[model samples]
Target: MTKHFTMGGTATFDFIELLGGYIVAMTGDFDGGAFARVVGEPRVQGNKTYLDMEHTFIRKDGSTIQTRDQSVLTAVEGEARLLGATTYNVVKTTGAFEGLTGQFRSWGSVDPATGQGVLRFWGSIGEASAKAA
Candidate 1:
């Protein structure tokens, strides 16, 4: 049977450089601070831009989940805020999540200056085997 679940979190990013790309970091109260990092290359097309990224979610217990995430970010209504829709898949898991596999679909928004963002995501899991990929 497929185990379904939902997750919500907050995220932030730091600009390393244009050529070097950026590092996006996120965390939440799930499993005592489930922190995640995303590294991606940003590209623009027309009035929208997207980032093809690799994300890793690490829990305090040392369990980890990795995914290849694709996000489309657009400036919201002529404001300084940017909204995003991210779709990711579970590529790997380790430690406590060794046998786990799952994916997540999330929506987020960020501030250009502070890089802080609000995140909300939900998806289904395979079965110790869990969700939040």
Candidate 2:
């Protein structure tokens, strides 16, 4: 049997002058690590330009987890790489459990005609895996 989990959130990226890089802040229902920050260099492989980042997520319960993320704005023609993994505390809210850790992986590609980038992700929190649901 396959269980589905769905999380929606928005992320903002800002360039850090002193850090000489960028930081991403996220927020929303299925999102934490709003304050989580990463520092790394950006590189391009084929048509994909990505930033490899290292950051930490601190949950409302005060537990923390480290993460390494690689965000690609584009993919080479038709290819995907294992970006990274995440394991962090999940807060219990009105609808869900208060604290848990989850793992997620993401992939991205660009439209050949429009050049628009698209990203798709899959994640698991506990034994439940998340799809479009």
Candidate 3:
């Protein structure tokens, strides 16, 4: 069986220059007090933008759950917003998150100017074996 989760958070990013794109280190605070950190690269080519990122969720005890996801980001014409949808796959787990494996379909937006934004995620998680079926 799968278990569902819904989380919303506000995130901030610090960007670094890259040849073909930009890299960011992101930090956030989630509704349930969980902390999030991410390392991502956003590339702009022609009229398209893409993101490759890894997300880390930290618990109070300092253990973490990690996921990797990739998606395309679309800029809202005449607005400063960019929206994206992606599936985050569990890549690592620890402590209370041990054996946790699943994917989360996440939707979010970020403002390039301030490097700040809000994100909401809703998805189901299950064992690796269970999901294979």
Candidate 4:
């Protein structure tokens, strides 16, 4: 049997000069605080620019649910010609359990007037088996 868990969180991005990347730290009420660091290389593939990223997440409670994630980000035009949206395809791998893998999709767009962006993502785990399982 497969058991599923869903979590929603907000992240803050900090640019690191030495590393030449952004460090994202996210915290949520649902399961305490979770931290993730992402590093990426930017490349222009054809007409679109792409970011190849590698990241990891660890829970504050010292649980073994740490995961290594890879994501690709792309830009798109919204219904209005002036509006733009960004989308991501995220893949994750973890050792917390046997066959622990997850795939997630997310999208973000800024409110033109306020300049604030909203990001949302959902993830699903597949055929996971923990020691307890």
- Residues forming the 10-long window of minimal summed lDDT in candidate 3: 19-28
In order of TM-score, best first, we have 1, 3, 4, 2
Candidate 3, 20-132: lDDT as tens digits = 23233323333222333334656887655887766666656665667787766777778887786667788987775677677776677777785555556665554556544
Candidate 4 Cα errors over 4 Å, as ranges = 29-41, 45-47, 64-99, 109-118, 128-133
lDDT of 4 by residue, 10-42 (tens): 554444557644454555532433333344655
Tens digit of per-residue lDDT, candidate 1, span 18-96: 4344455555543433334446557888757887777667767777777777888887676888888888777887776
Ranking by lDDT: 1, 3, 2, 4
Which residue pairs in model 1 clash with each other?
Answer: none
Question: What CA root-mean-square deviation does each model show from the true structure?
Answer: 5.5, 9.5, 5.4, 6.3
* Model 3 collision count: 0
Among the numbered candidates, top TM-score falls to 1
* 2 or 3, greater by TM-score: 3
Per-prediction TM-score, please?
0.69, 0.43, 0.65, 0.52
Predicted structure with the largest lDDT when compared to the true one: 1
Residue 48 miss distance in model 1 (angstroms): 1.4
Please report the TM-score between candidate 1 and the true structure.
Answer: 0.69
